[model samples]
Target: MTDDLPVLRGLLASGAPLTWVFTGDSITHGLIHTRGARNYVDHLHELIRGDAGRVQDTVVNTAITGWRADLILGDFARRVTHWRPDVVTLMIGTNDCTTQWLDPVIEVTAFAASITEVVRRARDDGGIPVLQTPPTVDLHHAPDRARIGEFAQAVREVAAREGVILVDQHAAFTAFSEGTGPGNDDMAWGLLDDAFHPNAAGHALLALGWADALGFDAVSSPVRTDLAARVAVARHPQWPPA
Candidate 1:
């Protein structure tokens, strides 16, 4: 078992209810591109509540659309602290990548520092922190956020430095897109709804990654989302950036 699995499993084994808080940007907000489909957090909710027998457990998404790491840090106490979560899942860096380039004050190092502080605060509140790297995007489609890979790396570095659990969604998605990873996901189908957010198909992979990290094996359940993906790609194959 990986070091991270035990931390989450121990909490479940404790026989007490688990309170999970998911915080980040739009992707974590699980809107727009989802097209009325359930996002990753929703899928995990079913698995945790249905399969894991944590029906009483509370899972909340405190993410705000278009928000950044620093914003989350600034509002940490209210968004995260008040809940006193047992497990905190953080996925960000998409917007931060753009602002780090366009905005004078926000840089990669500062982004990393802000993310690190978020994790630190979660830990301080007696919560287990899990860092999820933002999924890879079409660099051609989202040029302003081209440096997202660097920010994704920043998350990896922080997870290592903080010794927290990490779900490397960026790497996983890249491998699938490039035909390098197990399971036929990646670019064979349209994982992204557009340049900015993931559709239901993409969200499935996100949920799969989280379920794997937590030792749950809830398969993708986006039948309608899959059909939507087919139609989307047929209409615009290059929308996802090649």
Candidate 2:
């Protein structure tokens, strides 16, 4: 870890103003809650602004609920390329592991290829790519532990081969799920609601993992936002409504 600090520092100091594009399923989309600040992306935005001391950093959340890797890749060719973010983080595979698409090996391989392609395109267009393994879900409720593990492994392999950074969120979440440390609680496994989608606590855990992967000091402080305010601004009559 000591030896890696210099490299991390260098990456941080790079002249480019950091622009992160987060892509994935409902987690990335910030679902299971009302529109506005309740989602992870909003939490992430506040965290970055407070910790990094710069609100100029760009972040785009292109996540759609119930999306798979293939669907995400389809949009990558258009939306992602246009954004050209400095770093792209992906948190997918949950939807792919559903019973509707249970071919773990094939799905993992395809997902990995999609990620590789996105990275390659980013490089060609001048950008850095970072991949994140999906967080650990409630296996008791989801009943797809083996497939999830396989998907995580595939993400790691793809990241290595592509020379991109990989955040092993699955492993970290598992450590917490198994009662390893501070995050050792049922909420850490996103089981509070008996669903795979994480609650506020779960998203907070993810933000910490992201901070570590990005070589920033881990801070557990929560940055609360006014959901009504954000929604009001987003839905202003001057702008188009979703």
Q: What is the C-alpha lDDT of each candidate?
A: 0.79, 0.65
**lDDT per residue (tens digit) for residues 12-87 in model 2:** 6764457778888887787764323356677677777665654678888988887877777778765576787766
Instruction: Count the clashes in each prediction.
Output: 2, 0
- Put down candidate 1 lDDT per residue, 19-110, tens digits, no spaces: 99999999999987889988888877877776677789999999999888988988998789999899999999898888434556468899
What is the alpha-carbon lDDT of model 2 when measured against the actual structure? 0.65
Deviation of model 2 at 212, angstroms: 0.8
| Candidates in order: C-alpha RMSD to true structure | 4.8, 8.9
Candidate 1 whole-model C-alpha lDDT, 0 to 1: 0.79
TM-score of each: 0.84, 0.76
TM-score for candidate 1, please give it: 0.84
